[model samples]
Target chain A: MSTLKNGIVCSPAIHAPGEREITFSQAIREAVAEEMARDERVFVIGEDVAEAGSVFKVLVGLLDEFGADRVIDSPISEAGIAGIGVGAAITGMRPIVDIMFGDFTTLVMDQMINQAAKTHYMSGGKLTVPMVLRTTLGASRRSAAQHSQSLHALFSHIPGLKVAVPATPYDAKGLMKSAIRDDNPVVIFEDKMLYQQKGPVPEGEYVLPLGQADVKRAGEDITIVATSSMVYTALEAVDKLAEAGISAELVDPRTTTPLDTETLIESARKTSRALVVDEGYQQYGVTGELAAVIADGAFYYLDAPVKRIGAMNVPVPFSPAMEDLTIPSADYVFETAKAMCG
Target chain B: MTETNGTKQNGAELDAEHWLQAYEQMVRIRSFEEAANELYTSARMPGIAHLYIGEEAIAVGMCEVLRQDDYITSTHRGHGHCLAKGAALDRMFAELLGKEAGYCRGKGGSMHIADQETGNLGANGIVGGSAGIATGAGMSIKLRGTDQVAVCFFGDGALGQGLLYESMNMAQLWKLPVIYVCENNQYGEYTHNSKTAAGSMIGRATGFGVHAQGIDGQDIRTVYSTARLVVDRARNGGGPAFLVCNTYRFRGHHVGDIDRPYRTREEEEEWAKRDPLKLLEDWLTKTRQADASVFERIQQDVQTAVDEAVNFALEAPFPEESEVERHVYA
Candidate 1:
């Protein structure tokens, strides 16, 4: 088995040699199509999901392949569709509720949180809601405050929900499949900026289990735990940190809810330092939670206190220059890592 | 009993047996609610419960026409609906008492009892919360090509909620097999409906292009006949319909709200005179369907069953503490 410089076992390879490359959007579409074909109970319901193929076009051609019966285009009623999704799931239908924008989650909170999340437990295991809610996260697309917020943390806080934030095309496909098959309610947040980014994906069926962390580039100097779009940001900083003789390990926690704290703590213990990067706000957000976890688990081994790099605590600005400054960038991660390594 | 115009007595064609069965079911609901109220007043039951005492006719009338596989989503005040839909009295009482053998195994106390075998989706705590769920069940039935239908039971308080309209709009647009039953029980909580709801209740559904009607809730015969027509239309792919049952809440919103200052006692007494149970009982006696002895026998038998259920709940065990984390996932 491959091992990092610090002698910790590395995760198994996600892609084999000469694997075909596909865009993150294409990977998502393929996963949905495959699942729908495999299970007749699987169907997609949302606004503009049928002929429009989603506002992001991530679901393009799904309408044609699945037909109108499965690819149902609903009225602009997020709460209504989400409730329907919960109701349908309990009654033997595996529904994928596609919220065009993650901001509209506010509209469906009652259904997703109060209804879907509580049904199984409230029913004392009698009813199971095997449903998936697919939406986008991250900022810097000039979409302004409402559309640009990374709200995965909100869902992660809920007890019954499983939150998946995939950073790459390969992870997107595998994670989507896993979420579809999960018996509980799951919310998968895809980074809008990473939709066009291409990555290696296999031809055959595969699924990456939830709660498993992936070590993108294992190192021994400092451990960097990132989620969703921030994974790419951390990876970019790894190259710059290498020039400075800093071997920064990059860990991608694909699902925030079923977080793989053991891997993160082991990385932090080996490196003696940890930095959590996420696109959510710095205060009471994903970064704070992960940093606390690392600090608590690897406290005695750490040379310095755990650090958190996240979006500035403000609504996403509309202007490009302002928005760019709000989110954590590669330079920010590099500078923070260099200072910590010193 | 005051038989208002447009009240169709389609149930007149039925034999004494059917009417007797309806009377028995209504009596069971009344007994269940009375026992539940006594438990609360005597401080035996935990939390609070919304009584469906005065509106027994609506639940029994509507649930009578539904098939065993047909679905129903209930409100906070849902004991009557559960009993009418064939939920066992023992399980229902056990659930209200938070027992391990309850319908929801004590996880859902009073407001959230879900019985899968009887096709009860659940009783929601949130006003108008079950509207979308019922509509979705309708959507599922249509997709699966089943002849089943779903009924959504809510109060006039739900008429002010936007989710109800959103659900109704989709139910009509897609031609889903759903029946929206609005039990306008005169008051939304402590306030009367006239102060809370504007415009006609039926107009709201009719505005969405859904067939809508209003019926006197006190009369079991009218409620049953109306429910039969609407349920058959929905099961035969006739899309959605809305039925407004004009009724009254004979008790406080919850067991604790005793001194109701919103409405006068004189008004309460006036509505009490048209009690659904008395109306049904009087009809049975006047028509000689059976003598007063038959009604007396039903009351005694139903009371015994309810008393046994209460005893079962009191003796049942509480769920293990570890069970708290068991079913959170699946």
Candidate 2:
């Protein structure tokens, strides 16, 4: 069968090798599977995380391999899911919680911030919380404001958390493995639109360290830094800007908390112009913070004022037309980059 | 180096040292509470402090039976719990004083003092937060095949919280080594016990198939014996137990409330008359043949220790503002 009953592709073992490139969802599954096999402490838990796979089918076929003991299916309460994850982390097990939506993090903020973040510090650095909270974010497919928000800003403000917003299948798998290994709590913000986006992911265990930025493309005229879903948009925008005679440098700070300010400042110095695009709202968005940092550090090196292309200062709309306008699309990033270059 | 080992006390017979140790802790908690009340009323302390004056027996009683490696989770009224669990006096005092050398580096203050080395997992400000944590600690102990057990100390008010039931179910289901100690201190911030706790506290545990027991918290000996039995069962791979220590709080609900209009002055006097500290002291003298001079010497030692702790805390410097970003990660 091409797909399991749960609408997930069978493992590579079931089919011929090199038959097809792995999807983003399949990459995440393989990452968890390989890690769980390597470390007995690693496990997965969420609503339908074990028996029915995940809501997005990311954990499909894991239960059959790891058994119900490791791949636990929990109750529908998001608060309970986080609460259990915190408790399980404090105990001997390492848990990866699949929060169906990023919005549901609100229900479990106390467990996340108070319990998970402060436990090790409060215990005087004796305890470690090596847990991963994987949640889907961004506005697309008309999922509305509640389901489609890119709320990485809320977590980045917290001290103990390391936010990983991977924009590609390879980064998604590698960053997740790193988050699983990090002693502190890490939030893996997966874009809803990028789950089906496929790319090359190396087999076997791999990790992407926190606080590093990747220069996806090199240009001389303007520096454009974006994250998560906007990284793809910024790349597309670079292609369009090139046709318009604008050289746009694309930098994706794959990890948000340990923000690679060196990369950002260097690019701003070289191009002497910069533009930041974020899927979240502009007010107090990551774009605003990025602008302030660049203005403070790279003020003398810049030739023109820094620009920001961000979601409108409003909730994600339900209508496809309004949602399209609300999110930072490739056309908006391209226009913003061209304006920065000019 | 000398191997430091605690003298084991069985629940069957009351050994002189065991009873004396239990009474000494009860007296220390009482004196500390009395000092805290005076300090809080004098406005010497900056923040609101929850006094465990009348509820001394529960902490001293339970901790007396636990090994140094066994873990404990406490409520907002946590000073007594930490003191009874053998937290360093200077650090706890520094925490109370909001000094840099405090348990949480002066950040947690009175509500969140923890000493992980001695197995005090920090006091939780939330009403029912410790239950699940202690349950988790129990799971950890069992997973490692250790004899250690975790004792969760919560108020009667926490009995209504759903997390308590959730933790209890998990604890009983796994037969984890845990003892849920509900210090029924009779009030939840001005709400009477009758109004807050519906049904019986023991029934809350028995319903979850955990062996439940209610004992007189005014009698330190009784509390210690009952806790020893339950804790011993947990150490030997038996299931969890729910222990209800029927107790009272002699002071106001918090440091801010001077006028306890909810409860009558006569009721307070009546509870105070059966003071656990005085009762244990009297019992030691009359029944156990202990000397008055010995008790006086113990009192003087505790007073000197507390004074030194206060001085250390007052002299300790506050953490610098530049260091705020430090220790955010492991």
Candidate 3:
């Protein structure tokens, strides 16, 4: 029910300590609300950000809190909305633009790639695009191929963009705050399935710096690096592995670009085994990139070729059973880590 | 009776100072393009450049009505727009030469030059790319509660692009301080406008409830006069408006197109006769506002400036090889 301001909890501190449980969506909403309140230059513009509060409700309270002038409900024009963000950012404003779905980024490719991403560099650093592009990623809501794809690799591959894939409430809140304040174009990928997922978020000012990886649970047998919703699956696998005395460690890379390969390499060197879990397609995805990093950086330390677990290399299906079969499940991570340990 | 008076024109007369200033701006744009062409042909300036030949009046006229802080989104053919909006020719020439001193610091050659200080958001390579940006900028100005307005400059070729309509709708609905200018230069790359557009370009913006107008883009005074009214309406909280300037490009789509297969030499020469520069000069001389001596003096100034720009770009250094990854982010 409370919003943040300048990274501090604007809520009455009547609750216990400076920490409480919050959902992933609330964490993200708090970041936007807080940043908007703090900086007059910051504003949110997208489809249904004002009236509908976003399809996923991640921007629920922004409209009333900031009023219509700050929280703009744009028409269903992805390219237009994105181009506006690029334009606005360069000309003395920090805009938080939301594309309803990650797949819709194709419509904004020119705006993002040619305009937003290149303005800072092309202007010889004279101009800066201080903006954040938030989009929902991952399948499972039966949105099918068009809406369900995890295409972080597409934007992350570009040289100019900073891609953030936050998994938990804490990370969702922390990274979103950092992104809104960033002076360059940053894309924040929020997983649909993680919306209701809960975690302990700080009740005070907090910001997780971009490009750093968090070691969620430490162990000795083997290490598993996960991203976004897959981090939850990796956590579940870790719970199961502990019962069998596997001692599996979990590393959640909050962002893919500006990746924290050093942490993964250090974990690999310590454990002598690793498994990367990602919900994206197995081929040419984040999994391959992580595997390559471990293979090249921790080649001697990795005893088992630095294995990986990703969704099936095909378009996401509609049926619940088929979708479950395609996405990387807890059992998939458990088995992959189990094999690496053996 | 047909005096080219900047100050005394139809109730909204600008000073004589305005006309000469606008004249100098137009002449500089022409000379800059001429110098760039010479350098590009000589292989001194790299990459393909989109010369704003035969269309200098539109940028100069529109820019004349804008303040230094007012924003304008430009198209690929943007050299004239940048100059008219106050971008230095030295930096533009350096950008063309891939020098660190260029507007884009050697990264965005030709199609992507920009100047943030003067509020020229950018010259977009994408067709109709800056429409949304101009709209957003309009939103920013309105939110900040300033009197500055934004201008989105596109060609008649962009009539088919959905981006223009989308941005226009928002600007009108929100009463954003934005003006959409369609330079109906009769060509979108190789295809002519008549071959591609569906209806009147003005109708497209009007469909979204924005005010619209059509003008003879070859006449610099007409452009300035028309833009002044619309720009004021925007800055003063009257929603968005549209201006479809019926213009032409005497040169090809690009430097080497030759425009051979597209049209005949006679058509090119025909448009050349209605050249905007010549029209402005005749208006000034016939009205006794400026004599042959004034024209001679302005020509010498622009020529010398262009030559200096070339030498500056040639002397400037290229960016360091190690900085290839810099500015991708802050």
Cα deviation at B105, candidate 2, in Å, is: 3.6
Candidate 1 error regions (>4 Å) = A1-13, B1-8
Interface RMSD of candidate number 3: 1.2
lDDT score, residue A243, model 3? 87
Give the local distance difference test score of model 3.
0.86
What lDDT does candidate 1 reach at residue A233? Answer: 88
DockQ preference between candidates 2 and 3, better one: 3
Tell me candidate 2's TM-score on chain B. Answer: 0.93
lDDT by residue for model 2 (A260-341), tens: 8888999999999989988878888889888877877899999888888778888888999788888888988887677766
iRMSD (1 decimal) for each model: 0.7, 2.6, 1.2
Quote the positional error of residue B281 for candidate 1 in Å. 0.8
Clashes of each: 0, 0, 4
Better of 1 and 2 by TM-score: 1
Question: Which residue runs of candidate 3 sit more than 4 Å off their true CA positions?
Answer: A1-18, B1-12
Q: What does the lDDT come to for candidate 2?
A: 0.79
TM-score of chain A of 3: 0.94
What is the C-alpha lDDT profile of model 1 across A1-342, one tens digit per residue?
343332223344645556587999999999999999999999999999999999999998998898999999999999999989988898889999999888889899999889998999888899999999999898999999999999888999988899999988888999999999999999999999989988777899999898899887889999999999898888779889999999999999999989999999999999999999999988889999999999999999999999999899999999998999999999999999999999
- Cα error, candidate 3, residue A108 (Å): 1.8
What TM-score does each of the candidates earn? 0.97, 0.87, 0.95
Candidate No. with top TM-score: 1
